[model samples]
Target: MLEIEQFLHWQRAIGRSQNTVRSYARHLSQFYRWLAARGIVWDELDFRQLCDFVAVLTAGLPPLPSRCGGRAPGTVKAVSAAVREFYEFHRVEGRGPQDLVLTRNPSKLPRRAHSFLAHLEHRRPREVSRLARPDRQSAETVQVIDFETDFAKLLAAASTTRDRLLLSAQYDLGLRVGQALGLRHGDLNPMRRQVMIRRRDDNANGALSKQKTQFIVEAPRRFFDLYAAYLLGEIAHVDSDYVFVNLSRPPVGGPMTYSNAYQLIERIGAAAGIDDLNPHMLRHTHATALAKAGWTAAEIAARLGQSHSASADVYIHLASDDLAEKLRTTEHLVWREPQQYRLKGDGDGAR
Candidate 1:
């Protein structure tokens, strides 16, 4: 019999998230139960058996709605990771046969070009997706001005300045919701007019850094003043508390929920006559705007916490001056001027 409890203990000790640990536990339990039904023990498992297990999971089953809804990519990946980790853990412990192996690939389903966007449209509780179909031969084009105008309206119409600030931070500063919510009173240096986003302390619960690296975001004078005044209110609590919180008399901390933050954006969009504006779209706008403003792709990627690799090229392409710079930087030989250091008017070099 496999000692599942011992493995779970080790996982918790390793500082995995509560949700992650719970998910791993659930997946391993299901796997163990399935193996039990077949009268097979973990020690006796092999790669072939593991492959069969994945095949069974991939087999077309009756479509039933789950809490996560029908078969999500994230859920599938998590389950697969749990199973692989379990076997790998046993192998490392020297208790199970080394023959046991699980494929790391989660989506055995056939690749579909727009499946993810479709899933987002259909499965997501609140959001709607609309992907445009363009001619393959014609160059793909996006109306950046439209995106900016719509997003700016959304930010302006926010019910509270805090909500406006949140949107502004996402669009202007390129911060994730977690990072935004994680901001603290002390993080803002009004004297210097710069916000330091080092380690986030969201609430009494506390939050850990998602990227592990601390960065600073420069705010405009008006934004800094709004933040300063917001801090001065009786609603503001301790110096370590989150900057944005419920506007209660006592000032309940721990930051707002992710859903509330999203709903705030959506609500603002509705008010601003913009149908859809998401947090991620704001992030995209931030990156695209920076690129358009002649900022290097590397700089955008660093600020956006993105990988400095191939996709960086997209930012480069998005840059406004790329074409102009390329043309200007090309060098051409005006004249040969050879033949023993010839004078300004040589036969070969004369205009």
Candidate 2:
């Protein structure tokens, strides 16, 4: 445990956010506990032991009291990363074996194309190498919901002004759920119509941004109206600094948790007849709308607080489908049937 403390201290010393340090600690603690239960010493950890640990995690064995179900691919990948980092730390400190290895393969195109144009393009194909470490599975394509239309329905279905504002922040300003929940009253500048997303280690209810940098996003005047109404009406007596809070009986005046936000969205979505509504989906919907409106990749990235334009590629890809549809629709407009020619009937006696 002292070693684990040392590792966490090292992480913080290097400027890792508190949320990140906590995640690393949780993942490492789980791994160490599993090792202790199996009588596996740290010095004995190797490739085979790592594989077994992954299998146990993937299978969710021994049935932990919390989250006893099988882990998702993303969860498995995160756990793998934490374990690898822990081993690497010990190995660097000369306190553990240095032979541990983790394999990862690069993303590549598949051999068979799903479309004729893809086959004709002759994209380079790649196969998994037996010697390489297994790569994480690709994430599912971003779902493109009609933000302007669906968001209206969501807002209409919301039971309170707070829920309506929460939905609006994510869709209008492209905020992650954590960012939206982390907002404070002072973070808003109504005169400028902008809100700041700050990075703080003490926000127990909110996760820090991936980039860990403070940035501002435009919040329209209408959002300010809803925000003001929520501030002075629903949560007027609450003393919390968090912008969003629970209005229910059990946890009134408490900061809203991710689960709380998810359940609220789920209920509202069911009421609105929308499916799989999530905060990130709203972000994606916002990005797609921006891309369709002729925003450059860099501009979209800046608005979304992404570090680079590369992350905007998914939105570009989504817009490509729209472009294809437009091309199909305009085909007749750009193309015309050639005029047919008729021979003159009065040409004297033919040649």
Q: Which candidate number would show the highest TM-score if scored against the true structure?
A: 2
RMSD value for candidate 2: 6.6
**lDDT score of residue 117 within candidate 1:** 68
Clashing pairs in model 1, backbone N/Cα/C closer than 3 A: 203-254
- C-alpha local distance difference test of each model: 0.62, 0.78
In model 1, state the lDDT of residue 121. 75
TM-score of each: 0.54, 0.69
Report the error of model 2 at residue 213, Å: 4.6
Candidate 1 has an lDDT of: 0.62
* lDDT tens digits, residue span 1-351, model 2: 887887888888898855578779889878888888888887788787777777888888862223546775656667777777776687789877766644333354233336857657766534343222443344646576776788888899999999999988988888887788788888999889999998776776755665689999988887899998998899988988888888985678888877788888888988998876777778888888888777989999999888899887775545567889868888888897778886687556666
Q: Residue 113 CA error for candidate 2 (Å)?
A: 19
Q: Which 10 consecutive residues of model 1 have the lowest summed lDDT?
A: 126-135
